[model samples]
Target: MNTNKSGPQENIDLGNSKVVNIRDKFDNKTKEILAKRVGYLCSNPDCKNTTSGPHTDPKLTINIGVAAHITAASPGGPRYDSSLTPSQRRDSSNGIWLCQNCSKLIDSDTNYYSKDLLQGWKHNAENHAKQLIERELNQGWATTLPEYFESLISLELTTSPPIGRNIGQSSDGQFWLVLWDSRNAKYQWSKITEKYAEQELQSVCKYRNVTNWQDLFEK
Candidate 1:
């Protein structure tokens, strides 16, 4: 005497159903963009797992990644923001790339992984991907120096008694010495040669009494 229809049904109410679960899911384009922006790596800094690889089938590939929502796609979900609209919730800006495990972990423990923290991870992951792409395009010349050198340049420009100076090579294989002088409140770039790069950087560090300058580049 039981009659229940099986197959795709449009919001079938089974007696106790008072509410419908509607999720603002991302479209295929948004998912692909999110994956590419992070280079298909997990956004979790501690767990940057490669999420894509080749499958046994030559034409097929296995993807263990997901475009996870920074804020929940629906109400009562993890990190749900009441302020965001339906369109905003499904936008690429609200997405982050993560592996299956990390996507589940973030949802399971929303307290530890707040909205801001996830946003930071997304920002960093995107930046890392950009740097990688730049390096590849420039034939590795874009990353001749430690990545921290870029941040150091910015820090030295605003601080007193500038101590950050380094020599970097350009994409065209030309070397240049970058110097920051706090007295003038300006930085200067002078052309130099590859052989003098290390020597000049060391000399500048020594004059500035930066004994542990190498630590600046440590991860």
Candidate 2:
């Protein structure tokens, strides 16, 4: 019925009795940090929709993003870890920004959206935000798709590669490809024409069955 700075306080009815459901929800500050870190984008790589936009009222803004918990905020919830304390549950590190749909999707399916997977998504999303900021500071505009593939190749070499493939890029501003071998943790890359980069990216996307090529850059 009443809420405080700590978290939400509510009562739930069960049969003939009422019980309190005190979830360790993120505070306003924590939610802001999570949203800012991801540049207000949904952390789901496949669904990187912008979560905030202008409203008809100049004084107001609309937000469709949710600061979701990586681990459940309460008992018997999806990915709930009893080992975590209430403070830990409410911490920013345990939160991920997502659209309303994705927030519900993750909670509904715990097996496919494991804690590790969500963590990965958070890391990638934050890194993407950082890169975007850095790119704007270093250059005037966002990196072109080909340049993005080139950076992916560089990222692959520095970290874990995908599976069963070797990748490369070209200097002629043509194209690039990157492969990740999760088993061996090895990466192979080369330079090719821009046309080849598109083809290779399509091939890799098909292999991984992912709609977004940016998902491949996940470490």
Candidate 3:
């Protein structure tokens, strides 16, 4: 039996009341830019809710809304580009407005950590971001599967081309393809797929003999 309890007051205040710990003024600008870019709504195409909720914990670490950086400014990233004005370099094309769940989805995948999605989202959201800066931003948006696909395509294919087919998503609806990139460690696409996507999923599952997914398609 557990006697001790974690009260709501037990949580430490990080000084800011915002869901995401956006402290830096630059990051705040980034957030504002994203909010404008995404129209202050959730980025999932299927979810029309305002992005005014708590984001579940990602990495199973802490419970907070993780504001996703469309282009992660991590090590070995394209952060040193000399082609743009400093402001353009620090603009909304470099990021996105994903709710916590979608944020987690972004974190759990490589596409998020790649250039493909970053550039794709940039191209996709360019108009919106432009309007956002112009103060003509709307407040209605949701992330869609096409955005996901375009992002994946934005990846900088390695010198050695990455292995994996553009097959469809899983049926029980866990993954997008039979194997989440047989070339890399397995990670699944949480979003569901349609009939065409299902056919693609089965073909790859059978071709790769993805044990579980292959059997699922046979039926």
| Predicted candidate 3 versus true structure: per-residue lDDT over 108-153, tens digit per residue | 6565445565455545554444444443222321222332332221
Off by over 4 Å in 3: 1-26, 46-48, 53-66, 76-90, 112-114, 118-219
After superposition of all CA atoms, the RMSD between model 1 and the true structure is 8.6
> On residues 3-117, what C-alpha lDDT tens digit does candidate 2 reach at each position?
6565423343464333126588999999999999999999999999999999999999999999999999888788999899899999999999999999999988899999999
Whole-model Cα lDDT of every candidate shown, in order:
0.75, 0.75, 0.46
Q: What is the lDDT of candidate 2?
A: 0.75
The candidate, 1 or 3, that scores higher on lDDT is 1
Best by TM-score: 1
Instruction: Name the regions of candidate 1 deviating beyond 4 angstroms.
Output: 1-19, 143-147, 150-219
Model 2 alpha-carbon miss at residue 48, Å:
0.1
lDDT of 1: 0.75
Q: After superposition, how far is residue 208 of candidate 1 from its true place, in Å?
A: 6.9
Write one digit per residue (lDDT tens) for candidate 1, span 122-185.
Answer: 9989888877786677544333243333323123333455435656555555556665555544
Candidate 2 lowest-lDDT run of ten: 139-148
How do these models rank on TM-score, best leading? 1, 2, 3
